[model samples]
Target: MNEQHTVPQAGRRLIGLYPARYRELYGEDIAATFAEATEGLTGRALLRERLDLASHALRLRLRIASTDPAGRILAGAAPIALALGVGESLYDQAWYVEDVIRAVSRVATRPALAAGTLGAYAALVVPWIVALLCAAAGRWKPARRAAVLGLLAETAFWELILGHTWQMYGEFARIALLAALVLLAPADLVDTGRRGRWEVTGLAIGAGLPLAALAASDATVLGVFWQSVPALLPIWAFAVAAALLLAHLSARRPDLFRAAGIALGTVPWLLEQLPRRVPTVWAATAFVVLIGGAVALGGIIRLLRRAIDTEPAEPA
Candidate 1:
């Protein structure tokens, strides 16, 4: 009886490595499975079984953290990443503070530059404010639209005023876009009832005003394209592709969508590490594309297989 009881005890101890919530729900099942798997194993074989269980448990924990709706992992992660990007920019451009203060001080002397500067900042920040408010209130569509508007505002500011050079500010703006996408892609948000046409028009108007002002300020179409496309296209492609993919998967496999979003959120940091960590931008781009594509493909395959398995086995 002592020897027979020891195996189950050992299995329970190993299963404790998972989170309290997970253990509470699945601990008994895990221990029972572990005991069944190792019933007759001993020595090296038993050690291997335990190691496999440990590794599998860790993976399961990571999977839960990545995909748990209660956790809202990607929803929270993207904003934090954006905040970090902003903090990093502020640290690097500490002089931007003095410059802003000086700019404000000379509002009377250099009204045009000062007004333009202030306007640029306003254009950039206001939409972010709108997005955050909408997101906080669970108005997902408007939140996403507001974030897109903010990106356009930033693009206009860069093209018309900042000479179109890439900078950390751009990174922060992109991160904001991703955060909005994260909010918009959740399965619950996707299942919400259709929005009214007027609501859609209102969002369009809200986004358009900033663009129109930028155009009036001589942010030409050609210049905006030249400045924004190279930097923005890849991000746009990935964001749209991932959002659509996740939205589709969210209907049936929300865990997959959330997990994929969490992975997508890491792409920016991976890209950032390329210049020094990787030999070339091309290589880094390929690496990201390959890895992202592979993961997406694998998940899609699994979803398809599950769908097939669930379909009533045809008229046989």
Candidate 2:
């Protein structure tokens, strides 16, 4: 009875990290969930649970804040102070997509637009194809599906980012994003347990190398594909790699990982755009990536809170 009445201190600390509006609304429930997830805790154990939760929240917040576009859209004297600084960051990033696209279009060379569009279309197809191929392996699962959603979100953001550049052998942000999504979502096929067992390995190999190649591409190599089929190679590779990473993370916590990965990816793109050598198109791309990431986080937090809130409360 004493234990039942006693609340976990560390767990409360973890809950404190949430947006106050969130804490005010659902703080007790989250605290309870933390306790449940970290059952059988003592002093150090409680501290670890609290630390993890706080760290996760802090990391995500900083990542979103660093985004240039997100920061701009979120910019204001009042918004930051309100909702403990999470709401402004949570605004729908898609709202700004049109603006970003238009800004990017101004600097796009005909060749760059053509290459990017081709890349975008190709990125669109890769995930569905991968999902179809994995159908036989039975990769379908709820966690995986969630992972895929995260991936698609990531891909769309990257496609927007890379689409702005005219480089030949550029990274397949879309493809990687697609593959990542596929891994997170229902597999194209599900072949019983064997499907996940063997096919998972194949999927990993299929996705990883290509994305690495595309991401690592530089001036000379990318220029070779400036007007040709080789440009498609990076696209294909990225789709596969995204699939692999998403699959792995889905089994873990795809939501948090996606937030981290997408936010971090935007930093580099933005930095590349800050200098003249980087190009104006890329700067526009960075703007969208950062803003988009913040929006994504907001959506996820809302969805999570809703889901958690739906459950009935337990007796104290």
Candidate 3:
């Protein structure tokens, strides 16, 4: 047993350079891994490989703490890559399991999806990590009109051309929407644009176009691309926009519910006419709509409660 794990002190020291929290759990195991790496090593290349592992760990985890430079870059670049990958995957429909495995590497987070979303999350996150690196260097720059147009084209085209099956295409649409969110970044940060996106996403999800989607169906409309980029972006953007716009509107006209107003304004007219046209599966789509409406109304009430909690209460 001793000879099998005969890890040298310098190699162990290198691995042990990891954080204490991580080291306590993995230090011994890593020492064993290095012992294997150094099996024939007495050269500069060997030393370099050992240092590279430590360098990779440092670059990935130990940078700036504020605004999560890594997260930002991931958010910036990942969405487009996801759209491209899924588009490619669709292009290459014939799946070898090895290829399929590589394609959906981020599907569950872990190397394998047998565990759960946490693992899936890890898988989905690699590209976003790259995006975060890009964002760390500079701001995202894209034209708004062009972005909106690209989104419309992409979503509409996919909606039309995708195979007729509901399950596969539904996931496709949701993933496409996520791609749109990642792609549709604001023209500029108006101020300290740290937060305000949920309201925007809520607006998108709850406003006019929702009628089109009100009719429930089996398909998810969300294919798992390298999904993190497209998935969290709009919500993140929404948080930023909502915080800035609402803060300004509140200071200028507190009674107007500017957040809601902006949200309503952002809706497209086609969505407004969605309710009448939505196809019913159960003949009780109307009931589903009603239940959904009630849930939406309940959400507003909860938001009010949160708002009131933060406000100065009057003397009883």
- Listed per candidate, the RMSD to the true structure in angstroms reads 19.7, 19.7, 18.6
The digit string of per-residue lDDT tens for model 3 on 191-240 reads 11333232222223332122223222212335533222222222322233
Best by lDDT: 1
Candidate 2's C-alpha runs over 4 A off are 1-5, 42-48, 55-267, 273-316
Question: What TM-score fits each model?
Answer: 0.36, 0.26, 0.24
Candidate 1 accuracy as lDDT: 0.50
Number of clashes in model 1?
A: 0
Model 1 C-alpha lDDT per residue in residues 25-77, reported as the tens digit of each score: 87667776788889888899999899767755664566533355633545433
The regions of model 3 sitting more than 4 angstroms off are 1-146, 149-156, 159-192, 197-257, 269-276, 279-316
lDDT of each: 0.50, 0.40, 0.39
Local error of candidate 3 at residue 110 (angstroms) = 29
Name model 1 segments beyond 4 Å from true: 1-97, 164-254, 272-316
Ranking by lDDT: 1, 2, 3
Q: What is the lDDT for 268 in model 1?
A: 54
Candidate 2: lDDT over CA atoms? 0.40
